[model samples]
Target: MQELQNVVSTAFANIVASGAIEKAVEEKLQKTITDAIDSELRSYSDFGKIIGERIKQSLQINFDTLGLPGYNELILKIVSQQLEANMSSALTEHIQERMAELLAPAPSAIELSALVTEFIKLETERAGHTPTSDEFTLIVKRDTSIRSMRFEYVYLDPDAYKSEYQCKYQIRIVDGVVSNVTFNEVDPSKKLFIGRLYGFERRLFQLYAAGTELILDDETKEISTYYPHCD
Candidate 1:
């Protein structure tokens, strides 16, 4: 019974020894793995820095070989040129349009004799008098400062076989509107005779006072007496 007890004790001691050896090996392996991981971690920052520098140098070399500006400079130059081109095109177009408008021809003036004849007819009719053919001449003068016009009419002979007469009229224009008109007979001595021959003075004043547009040609002494006319 003693021998059986000793054998059992030896078996237990062997089992303990084996277990201790396995624990020691496991601890050594864990320490070695931790050290290796730490070393790799410590080198990661330097590896990243070396790679970054190499990439930077390679980019710089490529830019120099291609004779190209830096990215930032290139982008700025492109943007500036684009803006300048657009502005120049727009300005040129604007100037061209303005020059075209300025170079266009002005409207032609109305014929003189035709306007005077029409005016005489309308005025005499309004005054309840039959229009008669009378020889007359018109002299036009322009005032640029006041934007006004003056007209002088000399009648060759009275239709009623009376003395000759002269009439003058002044028209003031403001902002394309006929603001005021003045009429006078030059020969007051022949007033009664002029009145009897053509009662057109009062009618002329009325026609202009009622918002009539008068287009006159200073160069040719002609006037436009019709509506739907241009200045």
Candidate 2:
């Protein structure tokens, strides 16, 4: 066993000294991993073309017909109404379904920008002076349960937050009306603070709004976050 170990060690040492291991790693892994990383970093930019193609193929409606996205639903409704008479009800309903399912979802990445804007707006209001994006930063975290109540006014119960964040809040978020989701009469317990929520379609997210000292710098400390893949 001792002799065998020595022989194996000597062989490994020779392989290392000859640069075979380094050559093998570079040839096999390094370029592949670098490429994978590059692709992942660029994936966000591809979202537009991929989604545009999907909408174009599925809806067969040119976005050039409807201008910006803000009035898309309204404009689509009018366009659909105009074209509805030409098409069957079944086809009309299918387009509506596609609109609801695909186009209605505003991904969390979009909301992150909006969240920063909202924060800046509020900070400006509170301090009576406007601060630059460099003034303060946001800390986003995936919340399994409702943890931050400072921003979430109605969702006070930590125990019920799990059920609401998972179930009821999910329902209210339909059609991407994420300005500030409030539970009026449907479920008294389930309401979402738009400021607190920094989430994708299904997952729940919360930004640190209460006590954490906000210092803005993407160049310095990369904000720690757990974001699920956009579905």
Candidate 3:
């Protein structure tokens, strides 16, 4: 396996040489090939020259096509959406097969959130971007076993496009298992949050009207929740 330092330094070199960052840094802000990389990776000098070219090649292609200025923001939005869609399709297929094998009779409720998280893991593998864990807060509720839930949300960069949007969605979950997932942004409205959701969607999950945390017991399948308004 390639060391992390070599990979990053190579990636930086490619970025600089590709003209992505070059336009941003002029003569006054000149940076050496070594200075472009972080010091922490200095010790890994052995791997730098050998693996650097591979890293540079891979990074240059994407930066050349997707980086700001190189490509319009709208195009980047489309690329992101397509990638998300591909990831979602792949995730859904894996989840379906895995769930069948794991649950013989099939569980009563599959948490969509849990399944979605799992799908994201798989999708990240396929995309081969820097492996990163998904980080976004999600809240859901259901009176009965959740049949399925889908989450969609969008984020917009106001400066990029006055009329564009980014959209994402999570799919089919019984109880709470997420069966499918995707992340995408597009040029759309100014809305900070927007998306489609199905299967027992809640603005927020409140254990009680009194506004309290809800605790669940795995063994008993019992829930103890409190809401502030109830009190």
lDDT of 1 by residue, 1-231 (tens): 999999998897997777976787899999999987666556366765677677788877554577768899999999999999889989799777754543344223323344466554545455444324333334444445543544332222113333323434444444444455444543322343333223444434444435444454455534332222212
lDDT of each: 0.49, 0.41, 0.38
Identify the superior model by TM-score, candidate 1 or candidate 3. Answer: 1
Residue 45 in candidate 3, Cα distance off native in Å: 99
Lowest-lDDT window of 10 residues in candidate 3?
Answer: 200-209
Of candidate 1, the 10-residue stretch with the lowest lDDT total is 151-160
Please list the residue runs of candidate 2 whose C-alpha ends up more than 4 Å from where it truly belongs after superposition: 37-231
Better of 2 and 3 by lDDT: 2
lDDT score, candidate 2, position 18: 100
TM-score of each: 0.26, 0.18, 0.18
